[model samples]
Target chain A: MSKVRVHNLFISLDGFSAGTYVTADEPIGDARALFGRFDGRVINGVHHVAEPITADRIFASAWGQGIGAEIMGRRKFGPQSGPWDDDDWRGWWGDAPPFRTPVVVLTHYERAPLAFDNGTVFHFLDADPATALAFARELADGGDIRLGGGPSTVRQFLAADLVDFLHLVTVPVVLGEGTSIWPGTAGLADGFDIETLTTGSGLTHQFWNRRR
Target chain B: MSKVRVHNLFISLDGFSAGTYVTADEPIGDARALFGRFDGRVINGVHHVAEPITADRIFASAWGQGIGAEIMGRRKFGPQSGPWDDDDWRGWWGDAPPFRTPVVVLTHYERAPLAFDNGTVFHFLDADPATALAFARELADGGDIRLGGGPSTVRQFLAADLVDFLHLVTVPVVLGEGTSIWPGTAGLADGFDIETLTTGSGLTHQFWNRRR
Candidate 1:
């Protein structure tokens, strides 16, 4: 079955998925160090080194495997918010994006779908989590739909109970403030059995699998 | 060498040290389940059963190994707010309080020190973390002073950068709203090297050793 999966999402020790004062200068707020621990491959991302395989690299490399399409928040799509005026701004990743699969970017301001060279397509959708998941599910083509998040997006899909699995990498730093997963996720463990995987890099990968 | 310590402190997957709405009916709010993971002694407490050894039991048993004196937030002392009207209420523990050493309870209202049958003597002080630590260190008699917490209290000590070691047990559960440890703890990880120990019981014990 095509499951909705949130893979390799790194959060602060304080449970903040992001940090404060996010701008082009610090696109992910002050969460640069926190997210830096991932060094994993996102849909549209960097870091494709031939370094010896560590647990981080293994998990980071496995990020794009199996998943077909992706659904992300507008924030994850770009630093721009509200009406997108920057015509040249495609995404954070230059040229070839990481998520080679079709991606549904949840946004209020809709635009025509964008196509990248490496099978990466950015489809902007002005819809809720359920509506967006439906759109992504179809594009997934029987494969799992990866919920690429900036935290709020993950929380939305998780709130709708649409996520089949959520893989969270807990970084040991404290960001203090940012988009958090626990804001509305009370009783999240009720449906999922948690699996803990620790790496030599001090990153604890927690998998929340929806129980049958 | 006597080092300050926080042992067996349980935090939810979402980083909540305690849940909201802490009352007599629910002292830790919805965090009862989260904290229930710790089977440690708390200044003369329960569950002294000699069952087969478990990871939690091991950590709980190690809790009082070298601790001399203890300092805790007013919340951890009791559920009563404002002033202490109940002359009969010693603490949550049934009689022979846990700490065989002097205990300091941080509170706004000062009270005459209450002595227990055991060496556990409760002193109410409206003092800051440094002041309390100094008092605790003296009472510790060159032994380690345990920083007993309810989240916010730990945060206060952590913010002061007085905590030499923090042994946190990561319990895989989410209590959406509660007192958190992230706020005002931005540069905490800079001085500590975190080591994670996962038990068969699904509890991840994180030992943060403060850099010398």
Candidate 2:
């Protein structure tokens, strides 16, 4: 069976997956600083090459591994609300996205697929989590499907029980206000076995795998 | 100066300090099962014996140490709401309470002091956080004051900025509904330096100490 997974998702101490005040300028609250700290440490989130690899490098390097397709909320694709007024706005990742996979962006507006040089193609889909997962699975071709999140998007998939493996990192800083990842996920850890590890960089890594 | 501290405070993965639907039948929101797993591990919470000292034993043993007094919400003292009505009701801990210190119970209804064996004494106070802490500190006799909790009472003291050290444990269970400890505590970790450590018992221990 093709697995659905979430990896390298960072959250604040208050359980906020994305920061609040999510404007076009500050897309993910002010948590951009938190995620941007690992800019040079990881190259396309695959391999790490340094004199001494830090915990961030070890965790961030596994961002994209063995993923065939992705399903993400439209907000994660851009900051604009309503219809796509800004056709020129590609994404935060610029001309080349790191996904390197066919990404399904869940949205109300239907637009032409945007293909990037890095094998990242954003396909807008007006479907619920089950439908999106089914559509994404067809694109995945028996490979795993990644749940690219913007908090609200992740919550939907989690509520739909589409996630098989979850790699969540708890950053110590409190984001004050932001989008929460636990709103609809009440019994999220019910059937999943969890593994926790505290790294030297002061963050807690939690791995949850759903029991078969 | 006498310090104010919180130790061995357990929380669920969803940031709930106490469980939901708390009543006289289930005091800790049916979380007694979560806490009862540590039975017979620690002698008095500060000392450990057994051959292999696991994480649960290590964290459980530190329940009470170097404390002159404690401040807890009335719910922690008893399951009864509103006025006392039941004068014979000592506490959930029975005749010999584990706390061998002066315990201040916050409540709207004022009641006389109920002293227990093993140096435990429950003083019901209808005062606010600042006044209650002042009174508890006086009884502490220059020793540290432990802030015992049911979530709401702890939030009051935390909001008043009276906590100096907090040792919180994150248990990897998803309690579907519970009283949260994160309300109104946006930047609680701002001034405190945090240390995270995962133990073999599948729980993450977080130590937060206020910076001088």
Candidate 3:
């Protein structure tokens, strides 16, 4: 059976996953500070979730953990404007990013195949959340399929009770406002069984394996 | 007169400010990532130096132009077993983590201070290089003082020479890492004018006047 895991999802105290006024200069707001300790690989994870097609698979193979495929939304791919421009704006990561698996980008905009150096491809799928998950499972081979999100996209899956495991890295600072993971939604559980909680530097890393 | 300016410091490509072995649980060894984002604070002069203190005056007035203090040092206050822990730890941050004006800590240990909460007594001085500049002037009153540091501590100040002004956020990252700053013991340049630099955060602003 295939399972979906949301790893390294960062959130502000106010519940926002990201700030509203996100420009190329300041994509994640003060959240960038939260990522100060991450290396290029983890940093690439953000872009991988947004546009999995452009990721490098050989690097994924190197992990040995075997991440089969990725899933993300349109806003994460790039600024929601017209057709794909010159491809100059390569999803934030520098020339050669880390994701090497098949990436399914959730989008309403229709576009042709976007290619990059190495063997990375950008596939724009206008499928529903279920379809995206199914496609990721198919692409995963026998490995695990992951859901990469920008709040709204993840909320869709969470609302339907799709996510199996979640790891949220709770940073100390609060943004006061931004994109939230759980908004007006109701019926949240009383408590979650914590799998692991460790403190490194100042950031707290917590993992929860849902008890279904 | 002396001034202090906090600038982003360099950290290892890894998320570590220094190395791992050092922590409150085990304060020593390879803990460089602790200070990786030191230079991030220079732009717009927005340095984020965390201080753990109990003095309200220090917290209420560590920012603005020309008025503050600088506090730092390595093993001066860290784990006991490390080679630098010659005696009881008395962090250079002073009885209140220095910086009735501003404070800068350059170290490999990631231990929170023993006391800090009421006033601005003790601040957790991270590895931001410009912190030294921001601290000196703020605490200078009109006179200049520099807190000499171990190797990593002084190297940070020398790399930017932001220390118009110099002080050691030096504690002990290692007891036997050869020479503290850089390998050679050569002194700084003659024309390297030592003047003061100053700025203010909501807390206590600082001053960094030259020492000529």
Estimate the TM-score for candidate 3.
Answer: 0.43
Candidate 2 residue B102 C-alpha distance from true site, Å: 72
lDDT (Cα, tens digit) per residue for candidate 2, span A1-212: 77788777888788877766566676665776456444431335342212222334434544454578988888887888798899998877877787888999999998999998878888999999999999998888666788988778888888888888887888777767778889888877987877677676667777777876
Ranking by lDDT: 1, 2, 3
At residue B101, what lDDT does model 1 achieve? Answer: 86
Candidate 1, residues B1-212: lDDT per residue as tens digits?
57778877888888887877677776667777785555552332222211232334434544454567999999988898997898777888767777878999999998899898878899999998999998888888877788888788899888888888777888888878788877999988999877666766778877677876
Model 2 per-residue lDDT at B72: 90
DockQ (CA atoms), all models: 0.01, 0.05, 0.01
Order by DockQ, highest first: 2, 3, 1
Better of 2 and 3 by lDDT: 2
DockQ of model 2 vs. true complex:
0.05
Candidate 1 residues A141-207, lDDT tens each? 8777888887888888778888887778899898777778777779888998776667767788776
Q: Would you list the rank order by TM-score, best first?
A: 1, 2, 3
- Give all candidates' CA lDDT scores: 0.75, 0.74, 0.47
- Measured by DockQ, the strongest candidate is 2
Best candidate, lDDT-wise?
A: 1
